[model samples]
Target: MAFDEGLLGQEAILSLFEAARWAASASNGQPWRFVWSQRDGSELHKRLVACLKPGNDVWAPKAPLLILTVTRTTRERDGAPHPWALYDLGLAMGNLTAQASSMGLLVHNMAGFFPEKAKELFSLPADHEPVTMVAVGRLGDPEGLPEKLRARELAERTRKPLSEIFLGQSP
Candidate 1:
């Protein structure tokens, strides 16, 4: 799932999962979970794709896969509270994004998806909360995006200097 393989095909989906399997978790609880959909005759894909905010809708249409990542409130191996479950999920997503990038596929993590609607739509277990949605696809020409989004398309192109992010001092 390289960055170029935007919205993964069948093979890339398998690879992404393989990469996610190695994500570090709190006490090895492995609370991170995913419900995936490919824009291949999946009824859920219709609603899921429609759920993206207007800005995302423009570029999301190019994605081949949509993933909903969830976190479990309880540990799988023990009954302890999964305090770092969300953080663990983040780590998994990070790995997924990097893997996708390495594979030449593009991965977009979107927060604007309808989380509440997703919960009811997927019928997720009571303890599992759908936290975020990710769009997997190959990077397309930015020209295809709406004018408004085009300007911000590469907004995150550069990371802020480390000095501004962390300095052992208050802002």
Candidate 2:
């Protein structure tokens, strides 16, 4: 998505992370982690932006904020595998998304990144796995996007029907 690209303040960014931190997790382990950068062309920002793949790199770099999301794959206290780690991470992301929406910020999560590269670049711990990258900012004119993307963004939004999505459980 196109972004207005207005820089987000530290307080606003912290609020987003705070919301995510409060999300419900398995046994309240709270394993989600976020690393962020503002679009100020700093070294860290460039490195984080470079973690994105081509299609994502196109629009995400233009967004005012970039965040790298991660989860602890093992129990912090015991170092055992945490089976629900990813699910907890998703919950945290959902909270972050809700908080961002309330703040008039847009968030787009991306799977098109090199997680290993992210780990290597950021020196993430072995169990702290990279999950997704996020682009955040206010909405921008679709015209700011390339022709094909602009057309797509301008098109009517669609989703599967409720009936298709909420199937009745078989007895």
Candidate 3:
């Protein structure tokens, strides 16, 4: 997603995280956490940008906010590995996306980042796994993106039809 340099208010960012906090998780063991940085040219922002891969670095820096998503690998209650941690994190992200859309904002989630670097930068514990990074802001001109990315951004959105996706018998 394209994004302008407009700053998102603290309240708005807090609301986004609140939405994420309400996401359902296995046995109510909410394992998702986030490290966030605003595009104010601060040291935190610079370190966050450095975690991005080359391609993401080109566009993500223009967004007003960036967030690194992480999940606790073990269950807090028993110290066992949480099998559904990744799935739970996905649900939380879905909530975040829905909330953002309602607020007239766009979110671009990227896997193109150095997770190891993020872990080191954030000093994350061994049980926490870095999952993805998100860029958040209002929509901006696609012209700001590289020529190839602009083409992709302007291309028609496509998804698999229900008929193809549904393998079971029709209800």
Candidate 4:
């Protein structure tokens, strides 16, 4: 049960990626790569569809699109292993998610995907590290969600208090 759902048009999708392309990275090492899939009937699509966890499988189909994010750690710029590559990729993803939200599209980041299955399904290289999957769709009716999700739909999903998360001098 998302807050809202309005799928982006092709032009909007391009714009969203264009915005993501500019996110700042550690040492300017842009390590993010995205592979997008729509709910089209195809062998690859079916394989990816099968990789989702059962809980996600329920509402994910209602999403307009899916993005498989990966990070490239060893770049010519760094040459050494970039432990922060994944973090940098997250930053870019944050940018993408925010931009999509601003555009009236809802994004659900799912961690329930099977990475091994994703690697095989997408034919990823040995060096390419697959991260999470993102589901973007028009926000459907929460009431339409299954009983479990509906029960949790309006549950107080709260962020940790700043006092707990921040460990610095009080401003």
What is every candidate's alpha-carbon RMSD to the true fold?
3.3, 1.5, 1.1, 2.2
Give the per-residue lDDT of model 4 (tens digit) for 1-171: 443445456888887788888999888888898888666655655666777888988877556677888888777474788888888898888888889888877778889888888888788877678899888766767887888899887688879887887777874
| CA-lDDT, candidates in order | 0.77, 0.92, 0.95, 0.79
Candidate 2 residue lDDT tens string, 13-128: 89999999999998899989888999999999999998999888889999998999999999888989999999999999999999999999999999999999999999999999
How many residue pairs in model 2 have overlapping backbones? 0
lDDT for residue 129 in candidate 4, whole number 0-100:
83
**TM per candidate:** 0.86, 0.94, 0.96, 0.89
lDDT tens digits by residue: candidate 1, 43-123: 878877766767677666557888888889888776677788899998888888888888877777888788777778888
In candidate 3, where is summed lDDT lowest over 10 consecutive residues? Answer: 162-171
Clashing residue pairs in candidate 4 are 4-139, 5-138, 5-139, 6-138
Question: After best superposition, candidate 4 residue 37: deviation in angstroms?
Answer: 1.2
RMSD of 1: 3.3
lDDT per residue (tens digit) for residues 1-171 in model 3: 578879998999999999999999999999999999889999999999999998898899999999999999999999999999999999999999999999999999999999999999999999999999999999999987889889989999999988888777864
Instruction: State the TM-score for model 1.
Output: 0.86
Which portions of model 2 show Cα errors greater than 4 Å?
167-171
TM-score top scorer: 3
